[model samples]
Target: MHTLSQLRSGKLKGIKRLDLSCGLTTFPEDIFSLADSLEILNLSGNALSSLPDDLPRLKSLKVIFCSDNQFDHLPEVLGRCSNLCMVGFKANQIQTVSAAALPLELRWLILTDNQISHLPAELGQCHALQKLMLAGNQLQSLPETLAACQNLELIRISANQLQALPDWLFSLPKLAWLAFAGNPFCPMPPASPHAPAIHWQDLEVAEQLGEGASGVIYKALWQQENPRAVALKRFKGALTSDGLPQCEMAACIAAGEHPYLIGAIGQVEHPDQHPALLMPLIDGFSNLAGPPSLESCTRDIYAQDQYFSLENTLKIASSIAAAAEHLHAAHILHGDLYAHNILIGPENETRLGDFGAASFYTPEQNLLQNIEVRAFACLLEELLSRTQGSAATLDKLANLQISSAQVTISARPLFSEIKKILSSL
Candidate 1:
């Protein structure tokens, strides 16, 4: 969060990070003074539409974020940076991406909430690309050359115009987390006619609980239900990178109830017709881990001092797997099943939540469930890295990870089977 005054006064010299949000319409020449050391640069919330062609002079720059800007196209000068690997230009009006706009060593790229209809074929040349976000766009199809990116792990292509899923996309060896919910390939699910409706007038809002890409959760009291304290999520009522708020609320209602899932009491009937959910207030529970960092693009970053026993970790993992199995049986896919979304209670009670990425499917859509299994494997792998348990126990988890992450969809074990394996440990 360094200010322009500090940067101009040379007080931020030798710093590895610089964040400027002072309504700049042009690149600051003073930024070059710290070129030798700056590794992360954030210039979001500005009016700039382009970057200086000499951006490569910042030889150490590796990550750049220019989200919420006025850029109509990605800057082509980015490709000249030798060490640049992570580039984010979200929420822009980008309609075209030139062939040279991609970096050579790119690993993570976020072009979410844009108007891109086509991608440059040269994107396939980035052998190191691991994570990509292009959810809210008008893309009719993906570039076939993207199949060459064998290292790509997580991708979000929701809310797009794709009429069909590319067959070769399933063959990507490292793809684990995928969101293609609000697209043409998958038609919108019908609203649940049986779910209860709780009017907004019958509730009293309290303190804010938390917020995410989809909405804001708040602590509230249901005046009509014995004044019970509950959680209420008021959606942003706009299209997010994953998809629409209506779809997420519908998925939550369709998920019904499960021991390891957050209880969705009903939908809020508001005068404004804003989508909202009435849920059970999870007391004393917190996220098990934080979202991934710029460096660890696809991995969860747990608290450094937080340690969980192997038994507790296995219990949590089993609970999540059981809940996922329930969803699969209901023909629902919990697309964003990661530790960052799991709530950890004092006694290791687990509840898998956040239906923003959940989507409905038919019993015949077996591949989708297997795809979620890979996400479970990622969580299991993260837990394994945190625990140094018995040789046999560790070896068992290692093998389960292998089965869950099998690039071949059929080779991955069913969530039910994975639950059994975790229970045994």
Candidate 2:
């Protein structure tokens, strides 16, 4: 498979896979017919207009990634590949998908960054699909048949023309981690104070560190005597009330130097867009990919020893508890403190991220809302449930019980029970 012509010659009869990405500009005719054993094919970053009709001849074909291509229509022969489990057609010119174009065994379908205006009703027949990425498309509405995808966990339908999300969408039992930003269905929260401008040319962006509903974060190198690098969080919207960048900067600055907290570097406005905040970048940290539920964590770490280690789990829980304590001490309630927002860094260190929804307890807003209190209780319950039936967990539970009893109690004592569970951990 040195050249495209050679690959099309049907010489590599036993070849089970083919990757013609990065350099290939055009699809060679008869390329699909040569490799009957081909089970996986990556034709991404190519100039192909359509999939060859002979693609279904490969009996062992299981996965195909045709993203970043010039295809204007969904490949019809794909449905014939009964074993196909995953298909990625992102960043293409696909405008329509016929009802019979989708495969049955497909477990993942990525069609982001396309011109897809409607999804075929037959897509609901792909019962095994567990993940679907349809962001950055022209979808005005989702088909009612999508309710049949009982196994769907993550759905990214952001940046669409949706004026409202279907009621069934919110009813998926496994559905979590939904982001519908840039859609008329969901509106942005009120803004905050604006920050000063910072030049893009002066800052060197390193690797993309994290991403959230609002924006992306990058490790950046700033021009200074020491040339320090910091984590820069760039917000998406422009002309926000006070500006999200300023709000984040103010939160970090007020947070000060705390052992359990990531420190603030500075704040700067984008040269072209909204403002951004710079903070001490944690070297390696990740927001848990799935939901914050205990079941999700158990499923993710069932076979992974490090993830299930008692020492690692205790250390992370303790660190998060300490961080929450610090925030409460500062008269701030971390309105949204879930497993996903709690990042795990090097050496099992834990740090709380995403303070976008945090609420400051000042004279203006003295009491936390019922919803906020309930959310905190739920978070504490989840944390405690993860470390059930342990001595250290018992101790943490006792501490939470005392703390909740002493502090202002809202809703029910069940809320205190959740706090007790956290303290016991």
lDDT of 2 by residue, 1-425 (tens): 24565576766557777777645556565555655577878888888777767677777888788987898978888988888888888778999988778999888787877889999988888888777778778899998898899777557676678877676764454443343454565444333333224567668988897676557889899876678777888886531211233444555656666787775655665666566777787776765334422224212322122233445655665566567666656655454455666666667687777665443443333233322333333344444445545676556654553443232333224333444454554
Best by lDDT: 1
TM-scores of the candidates in the order shown: 0.95, 0.65
Candidate 1 residue-wise lDDT at 24 = 93
Choose the strongest candidate by TM-score. 1
Q: In order, what is each prediction's RMSD in angstroms?
A: 1.7, 8.4
How does candidate 1 score on lDDT? 0.87
**Tens digit per residue, CA lDDT, model 1, 247-307:** 7777888888899998588889989988888999999999999988887888889999877
Candidate 2 vs. true structure, TM-score: 0.65
Q: List the candidate 1 regions with Cα displacement exceeding 4 Å.
A: none
Off by over 4 Å in 2: 1-15, 22-26, 33-36, 194-196, 201-228, 232-277, 284-308, 315-343, 352-420
